[model samples]
Structure formats: C-alpha cells, structure tokens
Target: MSETGRLAVRKTYKLFVGGAFPRSESGRSYVVSSSKGDFLANAARASRKDARDAVVAARKAFPGWSGATPYNRGQILYRVAEMMEGRRAQFVAEVVDADGVSARKAGELVDAAVDRLVWYAGWSDKIGAIQGAANPVAGPYFNLSTAEPTGVVAVVAPPFGPLLGLVSVVAPVIVTGNTCVVVASERAPLPSITLAEVLATSDLPGGVVNILTGHTGELAPWLAGHMDVNGIDLTGCDPDLARTCEQEAAENLKRVLRPAKTDWLADPGLDRMTTFLETKTVWHPVGI
Candidate 1:
C-alpha cells in the first residue's frame, strides 16, 4: 500500500475498571501529545463519577481478593510480570514517545518495571510472616499479632518516569491483597493504560487494579474523602496537593501515604506495603 493510502489506527485510551475498558461517564476526553508536540491519542478525562465508580469496583472485588491465599496472589502477580515481559517492546515505545526518552533508557525502565512486579510477587506470602509477631504474656494467655489487608486503596501514580514510578507504587499495594484505584500519570498515561491491559489478561481478578487517566487535581479529593476507601497514596502529587489530600483523608480516618522524593530504582523495602496494612492482635486463654 502507498504511504498516503495506508490508514492509521488511532487508539482511544479509556479507563480500566473492573477488568473492563470503559469511557468516562461524563463522555469527556483530552488530547495526549508526544514529547515532540505530535498528537498521540485522546485519553479519557476521568471525572468525580468515574472516581466513585472505581472505588465501588475496588470495594466489590476486595473480599475475594483479600480472602485469596497469599500464594495464589503471588502467582497472579507473577503472571502479570510474565505478560509484561511479552509486551516489552510496546511499553518501551510508549515510554519513549511519552517521556521523550531514548530507546535504550525506555527499555531499561520497562525492564525495571517488570522486575519490580516480580519482586513484589515474592513478598506476597512473606509479608505477613515478617510483619506479624507473637508476644510473651505474664498471664496464662496466648497472644499474637498479624498483618491484614486494609481494604480498598487509592494510588496516585507519579507524573515523571511513568512506567517505573507506576510499578513501584502499585506492585506494593496489591501484592498484599488490597485492591486499588490508580490514577495514571497525567502527562504520560499511555504506559499505565497499557499495563492495565496486561493486568486484565494476567489472571488478576477484576477490580483488583483500576487505572484512570486524567488530571489528579480533579479526582484526588473525592478518593481522599471516600468513606469506603481504606487508604490513599499521594506518591504522585505535588506537596501542596498531597497536603490537601491528606487533610481530606482525615475525614474518614483513612490511611494517607504522603508524597516523597525518592529513587524509583532504589530498593523499596517493606515501608510501602506496610503503610497500607493494618495489624490485628488476638488473645485467648492458653488452657482453653
């Protein structure tokens, strides 16, 4: 076919919720452009209603996901890594176009993201063991504490280093059984939406990870104050926005993870996962 005769298929980036791709309820979309000022595609401009719907999906999927065995969750997460590996070239291209990075750097970022997911997958069954503890009591009672899922979590993915930053925040949240509503990078959302495609087909249960592409300023407040939402991660927000969201989260006593300047490529350790988990201590008579 002649170059002029060939038709290009343009993708309409939509929100991924409940394992399905849907347009914004408001029927709104915004133009996304390449770093070189060329038009890329139109991404769904998520609204407050979209945020509410994503929270509902996350809440509905919470029980099954949280109740699932840690080993099962780990396997599912590993499957995501496998799928991502298969789509490495696609993600690398998206990262390059979105961030204006060189192909080599983009490939490195994609590889790091895949590796990050695998790292979190290994932590699934071990986190509880590491975070939980047994205590010695003075009386004839047995006491032990264990970590538990904190229910639905809302994550604001970082604006820069889209793929690596996104994986860094999200892998830790869902690895421990907490379903999440993620706000993709506003300026560079293609990689995140593409990752959503990987999640949809990777044996991950629906609603376990909902990704929305839009302005964080429009959606963060609603998620912060959402009563059903158990936690919020502001790792992608600016200091002022993060502070505002933190205040809103206090309305329902939600666990708020404030934004911090960190190296996404550094070892994350247990802090990210532990921040969203709750501790439960049980005591019973030893002679029962």
Candidate 2:
C-alpha cells in the first residue's frame, strides 16, 4: 500500500459494562483529542441511562463478587495486575499522548499503576484481619466485629494523571469485594477504556468493575442519587460538584468519599478501602 493511498483504521471506543463492551445506550459519541489537539478517536458519550445500566450491572455482580473467598478475590486482583503488565506499552503510549508527557514519565506512571494493583491484590486477604476485631464482654458471651463490603460503589476517576488516578481509586474498591461503576477521565479516557479491555480478559467476574467514558458532570448526579447505589467516591469531582453529589448521597444515607488532593504516587495506605466498608459485630453465647 502506498503511503499516500493508505487509510487509517480508527477504533471506536465503547463502554465496559457487565464484562462486555457496548456503545452507550444514548447512541452518542464524542471525539477525543491528544494533548497537542490531534484527533485521537471517538469515545462513547455515556448518558444517565448508561449510568443506570452500569449501576444495575454492578448490583447484579455484587453478591457473587462479595461472597467469593478472600483468597480468590486476591488472585483475581493479581490477575488484573498481570494483564496490565502485559499491556504496558499500549498504556504508556496512551498516557504519553493524552498527557503530553515524555515517554519516560508515561512509562513511570504506567508502571506505578500496575504496582498499585499488585499492592491492592496483596491487601485483599489481609484487610479483614487488620480491620476486624475480637472483643471481651462483661457477660457469658463472645463478641467479634468484622468488616464487610458496601455494595455498588460509584467512582469518578481523577482528571489528571488519568491512568494512575484511575487505578488508585478502583483497585482498592474491587479488592475489598465491592463491585463499582466508574467514570473515566473525560479529557483522557483512552487509557482507561484500554484498561477495561485488560479487566475483561482477567479473571475478574463480569460487572465487578464497570467503566464509562463521558462527561462526569452530566452523569454524576444520577449515580449519586441512585437508590440502589451504596457508596459514591467523588475523588474526580471539583468542590462544587463533589458537594452536590454528597448532598444527593445523603438521601439514602449512602457512604460518600469526598475528594482530596494527594500525590497519586505516594503510599495510599488502607484508607480508600476502609472508606467504603461497613462494620458488623456479632455476639455468641459462651459454654452452651
């Protein structure tokens, strides 16, 4: 094929829901541009209906994912890291073009994202031991408290450092056995869409990590107020949007994780995972 006569084959990016890639229900799409204003590709523009569909998918998968053995969950998360590692070059290029960073910086970001997944994978089986407690009661009984998943979390991915920020918020949520609906960075969603491909092929069950790409402001309110959604992570929203979403979340007393500015490469600790967890205590009669 002559260079002058060659035609570029462009890819149409789609939403990742229920372990399947589908175009937005609204049948809408928007052009994604590189940092240099070069046309990259067209990404599905998710609407409120799409957000609702994602929530339904997440809720459907919650029981199975949350009920899985801790070791099994850890292995699935580890598989995510493995799949991500295999696609490092693709992610690095997307990061570079989206963020206008040097190849070295993009590579570093992608590496950190992969390592972050591995870190969360290691925490899957350990969180219960670390967060649960045994208590001594002043009666003929034994008492214990355990941490459990808060179902159907909705995450808004950070706009800056799309890849790293995305992995940071998502890895912790799913590692703890909570299914989630995530809105990828509106300006730089290519890397996240690509990551969805990674998840689909990993050992993760369907709908465990549903991803959407589009305007956060347009879809956030619907997710925040969705009666079935158990938690909302507003890490990607601005002050006003975050506040608005928090207020909506109050209707159902949903767990709300407010946005905070932090170095994405810093040690994240266990705060993110714990934020969406509920503690349950049980008492058993002694010497029955």
Candidate 3:
C-alpha cells in the first residue's frame, strides 16, 4: 500500500447530503455508545434547517435521477445489494447490539434487509410494466396508464426492525426513481448511517438517499408538513403521530403511507412498491 493509503486517519462520521459530508446545520451532535459502553460514533442531531437542506438536495437531484431509464436505476439498486452482501457481518452485529436480538436473529434480519434490496432492485425495471396498462376509452383517443415517482419522499422507518424496515421503506421509494429524505430509527440510527455509507460507495446518485439521526417526534412533524416533500412513508411512526401526519398531509395532498401491523420479517410482497407510485395516464390518437 502507498504511504497515504496505509497511513491511519482519524474517523469522522457526520450527516451525508448533496453528495458531500457536512456537519449538521444545527451544529449539534449526540453520542452513540454500544451496549458494552464503548462509544461508536457521533450521530448528527439534525434540525429543521438540516431537514430542509436534505429536502433541497433531494429535490435538486430528483429530475435527472427520476428521468433516468428504469434499467439504469435497477442497476444502481442492484449495486446496493452487492455492497450489502460484503458488509453482512457488520450489519448483523449492529442489529444485535441495537435491538438486543440474538446473533442468529440479527443475521436473519440483515439477510432479510439485503434480500429486500435485491427484490426492490428487480422491481425497478418491471414495476412500470406491471403497474401500467392501457386504458380502454369510448372516445377517439388512445389512453395509457403509467407509474412515476412522487418526488422527494420523507420516510420514518420503524424502531424495532431497524435494518429491515429502513431498507424496506427506502428502497421502494428510490428504486422507482424518487429521491428521499429519511429519518432513521431514533433508537437505532447506527445501521441507517452505515447504510448511507453503503449507498455512498454504491452506484446510487447523491441526494437519492438522505439519512438523518434524531428525535422522530421532533423531526417527523417538520418533514410531514414541509411543502417541498412530495410524499411520506410513516412506517416507523407511532399511531398517534401517524394520525397527525395523515391530517397534515391533506394540506398538500401529499401521498401518506400509514404504518402497517403486518410482519416484514415474514415476507414482503408488492404492497410497499405500490404505495410510492403514481398512476399517470397518457392519451394518443389511433384511427381505424
């Protein structure tokens, strides 16, 4: 290894957005210690401004990334799956420490999360065809229905199923070509930040996935009511907060996905993908 390559460097972890790593706009950070009382790293306590910045980054990258062909997006999502495979051990250990699950269960959960990424990756190239179809109309115009991303999505992943839930929720939004501003599980933000690292190293474009670590109750309402946010996935929100988010979402008619009681560890079908998609219809002239 070259001298620069082999030289030891201090480790620094901070908020990731707009293709760069910058400290939180609030300039506030929180400590993350392991169960063994060993400090892991400092997690950024994102603020309203930080959230707004993430939204801006997401919005800026949306048009180009979303306009890309599904095949290209599929390739990027698949790259994330490959990256996850190489870090399986790290994720399993994080899950065990954060959620207090057994090693085997942790491994299983990480596997589920990685597999979910691959599953959603495959959907990127196929959902448009599956969810889109021709609309038969009596008029002299030809009509077709297609699906498109709802733009900047704000995601609240569940607390318990940190790894699986975050992957499950975020993958669907971006795989369909939507940029996202996500609040990681407050109790277990490590895995989410680590996942951001994976995305950074993978083929995903910047701002395609912006992750923040902080109090969900404080951040959720801000993201929910933010005018720039096009949709919200409340899979991680508590019942009371979820209702409030639903109410606030009506102002912009933002697409709101309420938390589900179903088991994500069991098997996740097409339901997650459908929630982040919009049906677009196109009409053309066809004469006999």
Candidate 4:
C-alpha cells in the first residue's frame, strides 16, 4: 500500500449519502488539496438536496441507533477503535502528509484520535448516570433525571486539527445515542472522508454519523438552523463565525456548544459529554 493508507474510497472522491456514495446532484466537483497544497482529489460539492438527503438518512436511522443498548453502542465504538488500530499506519501517514508533521508527531496525533474514540466509547454506558441526578421535588413523585443523546447533532469541525478535532466532537455526540450531521473541515476533507470509510467498515450505523465536506461559511448556517438538527458543536468554527452560528442555532432553540479553547489533543473528560446531553427524568410509583 502507498503509505498514506488504503481505504475502499474512490480515486475521485464523492459524497457519501444515505449509505451510498453519489456524485453531487449539481454535478459539480471541487478540487480538494491536501494541507500541504498537494492535489488530493476532486470532492463533490453537495447540494441542498444532498444535505436534505443526509438529514433523511439520519432521521431514518435515528430511532434504532439511539434505542440500542448503551452497552451495545460501547461495544461497537470499541470495535471502531480496533479497526482504527489496524489502519493506524494509514492515518498516521495521512496526518503526517496533511499536517506536514514528522512521522512521530503524526503517530501521536492519530493515537490521540483513536484514544479519544475509545474514551467516548467507555462513556457510552456511564454518561447517562454521571451527568444525571435525582431531582428533589416537593410532591410525592419520583423525579430521577438521566441524560440522553441530544438527537441529531450538527458539528462544524475545527479547521486546524481535522482528524482529532472532528473525532473529538462527533464521537461524543453519537456515543450517547445521538445521531449527527457533520460538516467536516474544509481544508482537510480527506481525513474526514477516510473517517467515513472507517465508520462504514466499523459497526457504526449509517445516518447516525453523516459526514459532509464543503465550505464552512456556506454549510455551517444551514446545519445550524436546520429544523432537523437538534444540537450543534461549534468547536471548529472561527470566532466571529461561531457567534453567527450560535445566533442562528438559537432560532430553533437548538442546543449549542460554545467553542472551547482547551487543548483538544489531550484527553477530553466528562465535561465535554455533559455539555450536549439532555437530562431525562423517569418516574415510577413506589407505592404498592
């Protein structure tokens, strides 16, 4: 294999929608260059139809995926880590090429990304409890609160660390049973596309984690204000642009995660998890 890793992707990369790869309905393809300015491939410029199709796919796949047992989701996430391990070399190579980093640093970044997924996978079964609590009520009613996935999440990944940043944001959303519509890094679409390949081969259900690669300024607003999108992770956005997205997201009362300046390459604890999760309360009569 050419050290950059071998994926079953196309020579001319296309948009992956509804579990099948299709060329842009607009029949327009944009040149995607590597971070090093090397010609990567011509990526399809997704149309409004494509975005709508992605939402449809995500909606169709939501219930089953979100309803799956947390343990099962954890197992699947662990499986992704395993699969990624087998392909670590490829990711490392790609990261090295794309970021113009040395092989050692590349390996570290890839390891961070994989480790992130593994961390979030473990949280799959634990987050519901950690972020949850029993509410004290004045009445004789049970008010136990637990966290649930915030439904379809729209993630505009940070521009710098495409691989790790995207994984850091997207994995947490789905690990807790929320589906996602991601606008991957514009400058580094290949790695995101490569992630799609990984998710496809791994146990992640389609639509649960849809990936889109296009202009951030163009796609971020639509994703933010999309009626179907319930939450958003604005981690990858520019400062002023993030404010705009946050404002638009409020139009639908979409849950918004403000941009964090913390080091995402480091381990992200439950802080990130609790931010987007919703507290669900279940009540039962203890009286017999």
Clashes of each: 0, 0, 0, 2
lDDT of 2: 0.94
Candidate 1's TM-score: 0.97
TM-score for each predicted model, relative to the true structure: 0.97, 0.97, 0.92, 0.92
Candidate 2 lDDT over residue span 1-288, tens digit each:
458999866567999999999999999999999999999999999999999999999999999999999999999889989999999999999999999999999999999999999999999999999999998889988899999999999999999998999999999999998999999999999998999999999978999999999999998888999999999999999999999999999999999999998799999988899999999999999994
**Relative to the true structure, how large is the alpha-carbon lDDT of every model?**
0.93, 0.94, 0.86, 0.81
Predictions: Cα RMSD each: 1.3, 1.4, 3.7, 3.1
Candidate 4 Cα errors over 4 Å, as ranges: 1-10, 136-139
lDDT for residue 224 in candidate 4, whole number 0-100: 81
lDDT of 1 by residue, 57-99 (tens): 9999999999999999999999999999999999999999999
Estimate candidate 1's alpha-carbon lDDT, on a 0 to 1 scale.
0.93
Query: Which segments of candidate 2 are over 4 A away from where they belong?
Result: 1-8
Backbone clashes (count) for model 1: 0
lDDT at residue 42 of model 1 (Cα atoms): 91
Range of the 10 consecutive residues with the lowest summed lDDT in candidate 3: 7-16
Q: Which residue pairs in model 4 clash with each other?
A: 157-236, 158-236
Indicate the TM-score of model 2.
0.97
